[model samples]
Target: MDFATWDDRVEKFRIPAIQYRALVESLQAENTIFNDDAKAFYQVDLVASLEMEPYQHQSEALAAWKLAGRQGVVVLPTAAGKTYLAQMAMQATPRTTLIVVPTLDLMHQWYAHLKAAFPDADVGLLGGGSRDKSSILVATYDSAAIHAETIGSMYALIIFDECHHLPTDFNRVIAEYAIAPYRLGLSATPERTDGKHADLNILIGKEVYRKRAEDLAGKALAEHEIVQIKVKLSQHERERYNKLMQIRNDFLRESKISLGSIQGWQHFVMASARSQAGRKAMLAHREAKEIALGTDGKIRILTDLLAEHYPDRILIFTADNNTVYKISNEFLIPAITHQTPVKERHEILTKFKEGEFKSLVASHVLNEGVDVPAARIAIILSGTGSVREYTQRLGRVLRKGQEANKQAILYEVVTEDTSEEGTSARRRNEPQRTQRTQSKEGEKKGDLKVVYGTGQKKTPRAAEQLGLWNDSGDTPNF
Candidate 1:
């Protein structure tokens, strides 16, 4: 009988580590005597008892994960207790576990939670300047990938937080080399724009449990409303936007490039780097996007909405750091960007949570896995076409809080008659296309309101004359 043999050159088995599962299954089917020594070091007694009872969906998710031989991804919306669900999985499996997180903040957060969950257990940290190893360990993806070959066999169960990030080239190596018999992946938005999320089926496992934001609305999450506010660019801004768009359009036509797919965008980027005209076109595109995203009219509308929701905890989201800082300065609000120090970031969040700060503005730092349950109002001043960003920002406010009757409000400020109109529509349309039918009922689209400038009111007819609002009265489906 033939079995896996050691390979001296690679310092690994002749067969790839990823095939261990199939090999073991095949050997078992043939009634072969298989001595499993790879996981011998991982034998440990783990007792993880939850302080709070598992929610209904959590129990169902746990059941499904266990039913799948303890291997698969669990799709739960942000604030739907994905962390707790991971804890439940840990408690159920009760084996040497390795939890991989995407960010250092998340690594620390998981480390804290695990320590609290199992006070007596030996937990370790493997990222952010720490390299301790124990029966239960938490590590950042970059650190885990760097040490995958060495530490892959130390855990019997591996859980990936924000599992969508696991399909990347470098990160996939962690899962490929790890011989963990049981795997679990958790994510709110698992589908990547590049379509690489399909690889999770092989890298981790097929999705075993799933729930959308709307599915738990009013039950496990706060009821939410999506409001769209349309604002027309000023005369000068409008002219500039048109001119820049014309240049971009000319380049697209001459280059025969369609910016529909990821590959097309990459081609445009490469072409822009090589030719002067392409570079000019790319510059024009960026100018147009900036003009559309940060128009004076949108700022005025934002001011008004902030005034209206001043009493509620609001989160302001933007596409870039420039906009975040701009808004922060204009409103004198605390801002968090990639450049913000970790200590400062945490301090700002603490103050905001304590009501010392009513609003906090951010670019992309708070998009995922950051807990801010007190925030009930989220204003999207500007963002990308990514649905994940849209949903994540919305989820920041959907976390259940003491204000059980409080409604979560997401205000999407758009520049009317610009490319932003299409971008906003596409982001809102994503959930309708992918989410479960039950979740769709929670999304209620409000009437589109047009604002001229700060503290200025215009009649509906005046807005219509400016071509800000359409006559059909059909709002963009949220």
Candidate 2:
């Protein structure tokens, strides 16, 4: 009673590896007699090498995952002990395990964590040029997917870090081809712009448990405030930006297309590839966007913000690599981009953590998957409108550190009178544009509080709490 496959040369029946668990379950359900000889995973004694004070929220999360039969995703805020929670899961269900992460940085981080956590277990690395086999494997998504078929039955429990990435065309195969009867997914923001997050329910399981940033503000994470500071472009920059945007707008108006909807944007991209005029319009739009995101005014404001929070570790985030390098070169701070080599990136991050570098800049690479060191401040020069991106940047500085009651801050320097304002608002709100007033007023769920609007208070935290991912296991639909 196995998945059907025939080998012509051997003239023998073979079982499909991917269907191993289903066949085993079906066999057990019907009380069918069969000799099991293809098992590849075995239980091992695993205990945490270090003792940790059990957090109530983590305890609850582990309980919920176990209640769900260990096949679900746990959505928690960044730097709020997700790796610790995963270690707990491993200890509770000790078995051959595979942890898949999205980047080489994360792969190495997990390798270190697993080795430290399970000193006696045979922990191994599967990416970054080292392919070692052990009971516990930490692999990058690329390497794991390439070897998915061969290693399908090797692990019993598959843990997907940043599982939101699992729904991609190729990476999903890592989950599909594995016969791990148990699965756990970890993410700070699981919802994707493409709406592929729903596929996670089938690949891993439903959202078993979740905790937003505000939920554990002073406990698991540091008390933090997010302030919005708006800046305007110079007169010359403004005129040039307007002229470029006009060209793009004229194309859109003439073609009867709007950039407001995803479908319309897709149509515009296709049209852009088809004609010279359309392509020019696209180039105009891109250049205009660059101006808005990297206005000289932002740099002026950033210089002040950096000075205001001197001696404190800071992380600067930008939407474009150009802005990252510009800030790095102008301020003489180290920067990380996709182009940064793996060794160089690791060295820079280590130096930042050691206080050799008080400030560092990057373009999207520090968003997630990498273990960002504790920094008290985050300055966003530019970024997409994704709430996930906003939350992750904020989280880079929210890790509780040596300073008690340390009030972390995230200053978002936005360009005024451009598409950025609407984009900023979109990041803080869901599709329906519904706003529920909070008694506290505006700090939960990646919301930005205006520091210059009505009055300026010494405390940067806005006395506002707007909306949050509800406690009922998912983000609020609104």
Candidate 3:
């Protein structure tokens, strides 16, 4: 095809440049050879060997990936050895590999793991202000996307860590530009609210293996419990919340905007940008959210819980950086946010791990891909409604420890009689339902109850007596 014709076809079909390999392979199978340029340049020898025996589930996942022609996504819970599985894949494939991660922290984590796994080989870094290339490379998504077209052809295999981030408009280009015939995508939660995860089938491959938190809870992960603590807003905070909510509700009603759908939210955002009334409504909405997320009553309950769980490593999560800073200042705890310097963040985490710091506070920075296996307690002061976010936070504390009877606890602090209640309920319900279903399946198979939050069920009355629930009921209104 001529250049103009090829460009037209590519634009019309939305065809990715990476698919050129498949086309060439099909033609070669038909006994057609266009040129010597179609030959593969990445015949790599395996220099890294497996350091340890693979877990049963990890072996099963590897077998499945090999069955699928060495290309697919594997869904494993965080701290369930996903990185090790990727290392195994690299050993089996033995090709020039590029690993893409979501954040700078994860980029460094992967680089360290790759270095340790392949000690004899040179591993390169391509993010956090460093740009070096080697047979095995670890890069942040932003860096990979920026240089994808230039260096995409150097790798024969591409592994996408936190592969859910790959489906974005920009990040997807990295997969499109690479001619790698072998690919693997890894994620604990691959489902996206924008429905972009479907593109994984084209970008990487279909999900060849899957496991949930309940699927490997007792054996691979720690036994855990999720405690929902409902704290009421003070009278003054309640009045302020009600007034701000009233203004927001009135504006929504007048504008006939329903936030039940994504389109409705987009419309509300655009409307808010274009008019004065809309701006006031937006401000009111923000204030109401702030009130619900960071109430004095919640802080009081947090104080009680901190005292109760003293000396156990705790990780506190919040919805915004403001709340993170507030909790950090109030509790005199080290805080890690996006604004935190890399050196400071590392020091904070190191101290927390060594038990020098009993607790750490963060907004959304630690929600994914950061390893904190020593954390046994997690307190959610405020968070988003996304199930992925909730699951990641829970996984942070569920990593198994040396003690066989170790029980990880996640305390979810929600403002009662506010919109956060519904958000919390919706996010919690789906995961619980899925866990229950998986737990029953495991029982039918005569396997151990591989489920978190099922070891000792806490009743509502017990929770209330323990000050985790209000006296009104399990879920108290007002």
Model 1: clashing residue pairs? Answer: none
Model 1, position 57: C-alpha lDDT score: 77
The Cα local distance difference test for each model comes to 0.80, 0.82, 0.79
Q: 1-478 in candidate 2: lDDT tens per residue?
A: 5356789989997765556667877878899999876668778778778659867678778777776777899988888888989998888778889999988878888888888888888999998898888899999999999999877878888999999999999999998888787899999999998899999998898888777777777888888877777677889989999999999999999999998878999999998999999999999999989999988888878887788889999999999898889888899999999899978988998999999999999998888878888999998878888888887888898798787897888888777778887677777653522343233345422333364221223221111121221234521110
Model 1 lDDT per residue over 1-478, tens place: 2547888998976766766777777878899996887653355565666568777778777777766778899888788888888887776677788999998878989988888888889999998899997888899999999999988878878999999999999999999998888899999889998799999999899887777776677878888777667677878998999999999999999999998777888989999999999999999999999999988876777788788888788999999999898899999999998899978988999999899999999998898756664688899989988878888888898888787686788888877777787687677653222211223234223324532111223222111123221224321110
Q: Which stretches of candidate 3 lie over 4 Å from their true place?
A: 1-16, 31-36, 429-478
Measured against the true structure, the TM-scores of the candidates, in listed sequence, are 0.87, 0.86, 0.84
Candidate 1 residue runs with Cα over 4 Å from true position: 1-13, 41-43, 430-447, 450-478
**Which rank order by TM-score, best down to worst?**
1, 2, 3
Alpha-carbon runs more than 4 Å astray in model 2: 1-22, 430-478
Q: What clash count goes with each model? A: 0, 6, 0
Give the winner by TM-score. 1
* TM-score attained by model 3: 0.84
Q: After aligning candidate 3 to the native by TM-score, how far in Å is the CA of 208 from where it should be? A: 1.2
lDDT of 3 by residue, 1-478 (tens): 2111344645543335577566666767799856645324365565664488877777778767766777789888787889999988887777788999998878888888777778887689998888897888899999999998877778888999999999999999999888788899999889998999999999999888887776676878887877767676878999999999999889899999998778998988988998999999999999999999988877887898799999899999999999888888989999999899978888888888888999999999888867764688999989988888998998898788776877888888877678887687666644222221234324311212222365443222111123221223221010
Please identify which of the two predictions, 1 or 3, would achieve the higher TM-score against the true structure. 1
